[model samples]
Target: MEIHPLHPTFGAEITGVDIGRPIDDDTFARIRQAFEEHALLLFRDQDLDDEKQVAFSERFGPLEKTFSQNPAGGTLFARQSNLDIKTGETIPIEDARMVYQRANMLWHTDSSFKRVPSLCSLLSARIVPPEGGNTDFADMRAAYDALPDATRQRLEGLAAEHSIAHSRAQVDPNLLSDYQKSIEAPPVKQLMVRANPVTGRKALFIGAHCSHVVGWPEEEGKRFVRHLMETAITPDICYSHQWREGDIVVWDNRSVLHKATPYDSKKYKRLMQRTTVAGDQPTVMQ
Candidate 1:
């Protein structure tokens, strides 16, 4: 497999490999190394069913079982689409399902609210919209590197609280049903800076799921995190992927933040399946 840089600094488009089938140890090692170095990898023109996708994703680590807030909750897959999971019919724009999906429009890292966070997320496009529906990714390692010396030093030991409820509430206050709220993962603290276990590269860990810095005053922490988010999500370090059918992209949840762009869901059908790899350990203990 050959890897080509998709962005000047981080994301890459990997070619000459078929992820739909089992891969040997040597090839998988190179793929994992590429993932550690690049943070994001895209493979095109590959057909993958759910079984195949899960098989390939397991090569990374253990798959995360989605939580109660999503339609795909309790399953290994986090379904992204406008159609009903069972009926397969278009959902209304104002429906709770659509509101839940709107949360995806905000820039966030996958499963950061979990105690262990996530290692990476692999999303496969089974169907694509005719226009719009792009996915944008920002390189957090580059973002961290670009910070001024004083600011970098100040952030060295800081920890932030992350929660799924906090992020979903940003989109809609009433989005989560009572049952969902009852089962939601409580807020957990994560180090504001994370270092890759393999490559030893450091990255800032702020995103939508991050509510506030752990010990700071509430509003002050929010304001500070917003400022850091602004610094990290700038266009200079971002790459937008306009997906095609049979495309699969894997992004490091530990080192990058991604968001879904708008699309005309009323006029088209789009289905994307995502599987998240659980992080090996917590960045910080509660």
Candidate 2:
């Protein structure tokens, strides 16, 4: 298989291998290495149903099930769609589903609110709209590298709190009720910086889910988080993918931040299936 880099620092396209079918160990090893080295890898011209997608994703590791808050709760798939799963029609723009989707537009790491953050995620583009809805990723490794010396030093030995409710609140304050916010494992702590075990690269770990530093006052911590977010999402470190049908993209959650772009949900049909690889260990202490 040939791997072509999409950006100077992060993403790559993998060709000459069909992920829909079973892959041999040697080839899968190369793919794994590329995933660690590139952080994001895209495979195009591949169609996958639920069975196939699950089978392919299993090759990476065990997958995380959708939480109660998701439409596909208890399933391995985190369904991203404008249509109701049962009705198969467009959901109204004012619906809670639309509001939930809007939160994705803000940059965040997948599953960071969990006690154990995700290792990586596989997103399959089952349906595509006529326009918009691109997925953007920022390379946090490069972001960490670009930080000023003092900022980097300040980030050392610090930990920040993360919660799904905090991120959803950015779009709408009442997005999740108090009970929804009280779900098991809703809040977790992550280090201010992360280091990749396989690649030996350090990265800025701050994102939308992070609400505050552990010891600092709330406002002071949030201000620093916001400042770090700005530094991590600079133009040179970001890459936006305009997806096409039959595309499967996998990204390492540890060293990257991603966001969803807007599409006319009322006018167009868009469906994506995501399977998140469960982290083998926690990124921070409980």
Candidate 3:
């Protein structure tokens, strides 16, 4: 397979291989190395079914079950779409159910609120919208590298807390029920500076799910998190992906943050399916 870099630090497009078929040890190793070097890899024109998707995902690790709040909860797939699968009808944008998905438009690292978080996410584009509905990814490694020396030094030993509730509150506060709010999302003490175990390169770990620093005042913590997010998502450090049918993208959840863009839910049908791989271990405080 030939690998072509999409940017200086972020994505790569792989050709000359089909992921639907079984892969040998050497091929899998090469793909793993490519993923370590590039935070995102796009594989186009692969017609993969549920079994094939699971098989390919298993090459990396065990898959994470869908979130309890999602329609496909308890299954391996997280379905992202405005249209109802059974009826094939578009869901109203103002509908309470549709509004719940608005939170995804905000930047986030997948499964960050979980104890172990996620190692990576594999997303396949089954139905592409005629317009809009693009996904944008930011390279956190570049963001960390661009920080001033003093700022980097200050963030070295610090940790930030992340939660789904915090992100939900930001996008649609009215949708959260009392029971949902009561579901405690345990805080993970992730270092502000994240170094790739294989590459030895560092990246910032802060994102929208990140609520605050452990010991700081709430306002100060929010400000710090906001600053890091703003710096990390600058246009130059990001790559926006326009989806096409049969396209599959795999992203390193530990080193990158991604967000969905707006689309005409009333006019177009867009379906994106995602599967997340569980992290090797839970996040621990130092």
Candidate 2 lDDT score relative to the true structure: 0.90
TM-score of each: 0.97, 0.98, 0.95
Candidate 2 stretches greater than 4 Å from native: none
**Number of the candidate with higher lDDT, 2 or 3:** 2
Per-residue CA lDDT of candidate 1, range 1-286, in tens? 8989999989888899999988999999999999999999999999899999999999999999997657787899998999899999999989887888899999999999898999999999998999999999999999999989988998989999998888999988787766655466878899999999888999999899998889999999998899998776778899999999999999999999999999999999999999999999999978
In model 2, which residue pairs have backbone atoms overlapping below 3 Å? none
Model 1 reaches what TM-score against the true structure? 0.97
Question: How many residue pairs clash (N, CA or C atoms closer than 3 angstroms) in each of the candidate models, in the order given?
Answer: 0, 0, 0
Q: Can you write out model 3's per-residue Cα lDDT over 186-259, one digit (the tens) per residue?
A: 45566677889999989888777898886899899889898877765788889999999989999999899999
Pairs that collide, model 3? none
